[model samples]
Target: MSATGAIPVPPGKAGKAGKERFDAAGRRVLLVCVAGGFTTLIDQSVLNTSIPALRESLHAQPAHLQWIVAGYSLAFGLALIPGGRLGDVRGRKWFFVGGLALFTVVSLLSATATEPWALVVSRLLQGAGAGLVNSQMIGTLQDVFQGQLRARALGMYAVTGGLAFALGPPVGGAVLAAVGPEYGWRLTFLLNVPFGLATLWLAARHLPRPRPSARDADLDLVGLLLVGALTLALMLPFVQPPGWAGWLGFAVAAALLLGALAWWQRRFARAGGHPLIHPALTRSAPYALGTAVAMAQFGSSLAAGLVLAMFLQDGLGLSPLGAALVALPSAVAMGFASAVAWRVVARFGRRTVTAGMTGSALTMLTGGLVALWAPAGPLPWLLALLQLLGGASIGLMGASNQAFVLRHAPAEAAGVSGAILQMAQRIAAAVSISALSGVYLRATGGGGGHRAAFAWASGVCAAVAALAVLASVLAGRATAREEAAREESALAVTSNEPARESTRASG
Candidate 1:
């Protein structure tokens, strides 16, 4: 057994046998991870659709109800880094199976939940399990596939996840409607049991048992605590009553926690110990910049969708079903666009990213203008068109951005690199949602507010689009530099090899 707990085969049979075993393990891991993702999607989507039912049944206030949703996100976001590190240290297959088991049990408990708090706790546990599953997925992929094959597999993984996000709500709604309110919400949680069990069984039977490498480092418990604290502090304002005091407290707490985390990581690096995120990779311009762009893009996209849903239901007085129908265009566009994203990236290189971001910016600007100027006017199909355009742009840019980041990252830092990106995205989403929600509430005059909330949301969308454009420009420059460097390095190697061979012949 290797220090990392990976089983070492005899040299003669190692190459061929390892390849065969890895191939089998990859499929099983992928199945289980994807199944977990589906359940997470179902949990989020079903809750959103059944919120009204839940409120009526439990007599819950808006604040309490929001917690039901926010609890899951909070847990999921906070656990990501720790979970990824656990996979790195303890071996992925076990963590993957354990995560699924936890998810399944909690899901069953959630279905039987009688009160809001009970469901909220269950959702938190489910989210933690989801975090474990997601964090290890890409690491498993890396372990199983290599080079171009890896890229293709990762692309497919992204596509599957995008489709799940797009389809979740509609599927949840359909199931809920069919079963009625009494059984609908319960069905959402219970739906995972069969798939989870199947994944667990497959994993147990077919997954390779990775030898635990004693060389694996201990978990950075302090770093994990700080990260969890920082995340919670950042998200607190969103869940609590909005006030200067609440916001100020959250900000201070977040700043302290983040500052401590940074210090701890630096200390660990100086001591030659492995940190949760490697300092070298974290400090690299490509990783840092790519992570920033990803954060802003993901944050803005999620905020826009949530705000749009609110506008459709509260501002326009549309039914939940009507709002969902209106939002379908963007979801459909995202799903289809992601499949062809790799082709677009290859053809245009970084220019494609710039163009996509430009398109997104224009769409957001147009949507904002329409919202502000034609508040009560004719329902322009422009909203749908703009959404489609924005979705496609995001789909194209996101896939390429991920590839570029991973391509530049050092091999040993893969798990940390992935975790950093994921963390940025989660933090961005949480902040954007809170900020945008506040803006919407202020613009419209609270829960029973005005149509102006839509206008404000439109403005926020436009700002995000502008940021996307800037990110595209910066990312393009970085990609060009990277490509040029690669070419120069190849040329140098080619030139040196011939000279060395000639010297040897002469001698």
Candidate 2:
């Protein structure tokens, strides 16, 4: 590493023709990564509209229904960090290919399931596969691109995810309408097969194989178990809340587990072991604050989206298709905004994140007011407009902020860094959904109706949005200080260069 903190480029690595060839190859690889992400993220939300059709077909019990939907997310979260670390130690190529293959095979398995229990198991495995693949995708981007080029690649990635999420409901609903109810939901799982296979083939051909590891990875069994248990402890209360006492117990367990994990990681490091997470990552102010930004944006945005879907269907009594159509404008706006976000980040840096957070907060507030005050005929249109603005804010924030956070990661630990960033978001998503939906559920049960429920939940989202903005500001300042320090050091070195030259001349 140089005094300026940049790793020096290798000799013969900067030739123009060679660089161009590498760039072209890297772009092809990027397309494969994005395609894989697009497939998995679509799976994340596609089942939302498939529940009714699913229940009717499988005659699934209430518990089965809950597991089918929530299990996927739970498994996805559980797989991220460990998978990322493993991909770092082992080559990413096999993991990416294996994970995608597993995902595809299981999608077919899910499509063939006659029993809900079988479907639940398959979905959980599928989520794990998706998690594995997704982590590699982020890590691969970090490995492949740098500087403004990285920002652009990640921007494309973030926007693709946003579009996948926004498209999930309508795509699922359209499938249901096209086919009869019985087979529609099954077919939804099958959608992944073709896409996954094509992407898998491309990945096998294009993904660069990094040099082999000198030694086998030291799989930290104890640390991995602790993290896994901690994730479950945190997620369960949100998914299957078992009264206030139970919730308190889980929270305490999570806290205790966190402390234990931290202690173990320190011990493991002192023993000269490669811990699952990099030690430097935990100490980073930039990482912590950037994580805060991602968590808030992901959690509140997803919860808000869920609330809108429920409000349209359960509250305003719109058809599934109708609700999806109303929500489509947000996706459209998000796609457009994300495509341009890297340019904004280039000009504005981290302030772009603050702007996005502020915009999100205001939009959430506006959405609440619209829910409470708009007439029935105009409610959907008005909410759609609100979502359009919200989507743009979210899109700009997601890509730029992701690039912002990952920028702080040490290259050697890039995989785990990306994993942890997303892992934080997943945990936040669980928490936000619990808090906001808990409020919504209580309000509706109290006969306050959908308007009151939405209004109260939106208030919670706005608070999270505020937190995101504050974090963004702090992160920006931290990054600025680091950059300023580097500049000063460089100037000091430059100032002594002439004196050194004069002494050499005299000698």
RMSD (Å) of each candidate, 1 decimal:
6.8, 4.6
Pick out the ten consecutive residues of candidate 2 with the lowest summed lDDT.
Answer: 1-10
Give model 1 RMSD, 1 decimal: 6.8
Best by lDDT: 2
- CA deviation > 4 Å runs, candidate 1: 1-29, 179-183, 245-249, 361-365, 372-382, 438-450, 485-507
Candidate 1 structure quality by residue, lDDT tens digits, 119-225:
87887898888777777776777767776567666666666665665555555556656777677767877878887888788767765576566665566777777
CA lDDT of each prediction against the hidden true structure: 0.68, 0.79
**lDDT, candidate 2, residue 318?**
79
Best by TM-score: 2
lDDT of 2 by residue, 20-50 (tens): 3337888898899889999998985677667
Regions more than 4 Å wrong, model 2: 1-24, 52-67, 112-117, 142-151, 180-182, 209-211, 434-448, 495-507
